[model samples]
Target chain A: MISIRELHKSFGPLQVLTGVSLAIESGKITAILGPNGSGKTTLIKSILGLVKPDRGVIQIGEQVLNGDCRYREDIGYMPQIGHYPENLSLNDVMTMLQDLRGGKHPTDTQLLEKFRLGKEMDKALGTLSGGTRQKVSAVLAMLFNPKILILDEPTSGLDPVASSIFKDALIEERAAGKTIILTSHIMSEVEELADAVVFLLDGKIRFHGSPTEILQNTSESNLERGIARMMQEAVHP
Target chain B: MRTTGKIIKYEIRDIARSKFVLFYFVFFLLLTEGLLRFGGGSTKTLISLSNVVLLVIPLMAIIFGAMYLYHSREFTELLLTQPVNRHQLFRGLYLGLAVPLALSYGAGLGLPFLLHGFNAEGDVALLLVMIGSGIFLTFIFTAIAFWISVTYNERVKGLGFSIVLWLFFAVIYDGLVLLVVAWFADYPLEKAVIGFTILNPLDLARILLLLQMDASALMGYTGAVFQRFFGSFWGISIATVALVGWTAIPFWLGLRRFAQKDF
Candidate 1:
């Protein structure tokens, strides 16, 4: 479990996150939803320790994040855009990361085989298509079998077939009792995969509950319409 | 420490494969070879080479360092999410960039001389000094460039600051010193001039090499004062310390900023 309290962050007079408190449970999938500039990415980055919050307490399992990076060993991250050294081949990148991570854990190559990335491992990352690179990102994130998986827009560039494969992988991971957090714009994808939804607005958590709870609260038939109604009520009220 | 080494290893490999680094190595190789082949006696060639090294190394190191950091930002963000210490990551990145560039420079300049052979014992010493100075400038300027790159987010602004800094040290600083000397002609400016030279790594390197070449006589009265000062053991020690400080201070500052910076 990852617990955060009173998280605050500002970027040069612009407040991106303000007093965000959340507790992410294990053995479940949580989706963070927000409009652009609503601090969803900032919140995620803060948990990853990529962005240092102005004031907050972030505890992962029993360890509190106080500048120690060892806790990150249990977490896997897939960025929205998988930018890598242009000249490094896919094999080189994978090996380098494995070496850095110390290879202590039993290697997980399920996604690697599923994606059939072995054939393209010799290709330079710069030469790969966007969907292929996204697949590479997905493989690296799952390679360690990390306890927590944070994926940002994991399906954006994927073809329909690859997307399904990715979703299945997520389902398997969740069933294995791993905590999964993801952010996506596609309501249908979130509705399909997310067990709980956390909706952020202007740096604050406006809603946090299961998708059914949001539907019942907003009296909407679908997740998308419920979220839309919530946004409208927040702006108009 | 092991993690840092692993990071450096991959970084070096990535940088080594780039066309720009290859071009850099070749440019220096050809320039050094051309100078030795046609620039008259060994002494004259060495002098010309020192002039080229003083100007070129800093410019190349600064620009390349800034550009490399800016270009690899996304890759850096990717690394940041890993279970790696930020300090180690910064050191790895800094040395990874500095070491390759420094090696390309040293090997490029040294290879031609090794093939040609040194005619005199003094010539050997002078060549070492010249190459040493080039390596020092590379580390110093790369560190400064890193500081600039970390401080500025925009690519154009970071790159522009790098160029302007190179200009100030390589060109404008000398002009300014001359102006200062002329403005205070009667003020017994020898000590002040040495202090000014110490402030600019380029001048310190040039003067250090020139003193070794026995070419200080060509620098007129200021050269005489420099010879009296830098000719001594203490003077060389001080200059070495200054150069080391130049390399360390900026790197420390850059690391501090980088550690706290939000990716």
Candidate 2:
């Protein structure tokens, strides 16, 4: 459902994504795996139109992403940090979103209850803890149930229970045929939730296939070890 | 428009809780009341009130608007990733800031004037220009601040440039003008001076308000040629156009910079 072609981006002199291309199919969870400075986030941000690429095109369905912001209507992005207006209470934040979205989506009570965020809706964003803030970000990302979900470090601050709930939600969304592109360091989570693995390093795709292929190529039983082996192999080969 | 309104709604919520905006409101309210009570006499109080409006409005607008953009950078980025239009996002931000700031100045200076019994037809017309000048300054300077913030990614550097810009207009600019006029005193530099006034938004505001308050105070300095020019409808209209130009130029520059910017 989403396609990226020759995506290249650089911050100053340092190149982030250099001539990278990939396609993310619908009805599946694709985990973008990379080390620090691997340009994984840059690639994701480019697709979300957050980080303007130095060169290339990103096509979602039949339309190319352009200056017209109507394209973003299909996207639900959860940034790594749940940064929000400081003094805005959760209700105000959500209401404002609803108004700006042109009354597109209804209330998202399920995720609110799943994350136990109903009680915290009245608190100002600045007053919330990091994990709680992550929950808020997660809810916002899923609030619209958009065509594609771009989640960066979606479970970093969540507790085990909350993480599991989030994973279950991801599985359920995949079942509903929504495309999800997520980046995370948690290998077990990736192994469980992601159907396809797109391994990136130095701004190029090193591996793109099923999760089982990643393990088979590296001859590693676990997703974590398999990824580590892939990196080591890239360095030597 | 509805999108702009909703964005403005959220921005107002944020600004409503801003410590600087709150402090600004309180400061003006107290300053106006204090000036009216202590300065004494209708004319003196009006002049004093007008002077502070000319000075403080632009200063606070620049400082507060720049700082607000910096502080709300995260929130702005958060909204940018949404389906909201960029133009609406920026227009809302500008209006959201400009509205509260202009209102605070209006209510602060306005209420005192109303209490002081200076609402005659002529006085109201003059009061409007005074208030209009204050609004213009707030709009213009906030636009400049937004421009600086948009151009520079670093907060300290952006704020540094913004403060220096304010200093140039508020402090150094007048010094440079005085030096220019003094050095060229032998020449009838009325045209040059008028051109110079148009260049500086602060000077343009001061000239408009000062002429309305006490034309004679400036008549001696501006002279008969300049006096006739400034005292006429054409002069006021030109100054008004210049104020609106000042408001539009920087705001448009800021919006352009914001449109291409990747958040």
Q: Candidate 1 clashing pairs?
A: none
Assess every candidate by TM-score: 0.96, 0.94
For model 1, the stretches where C-alpha displacement exceeds 4 angstroms are: B220-223, B229-231
Task: Return the number of clashes found in candidate 2.
Answer: 0
Highest DockQ, which number?
1
Worst 10 residues of 2 chain B by lDDT: B218-227
Best by TM-score: 1
Give the residue spans of candidate 2 off by over 4 A. B19-23, B119-122, B185-188, B219-231
The Cα RMSD in angstroms, rounded to one decimal, for candidate 1 relative to the true structure is: 1.8
Q: After superposition, how far is residue B123 of candidate 2 from its true place, in Å?
A: 3.4
lDDT (tens digit, per residue) of candidate 2 on B24-92: 778877887787688775566667777677677878888888888998898888898888778889999
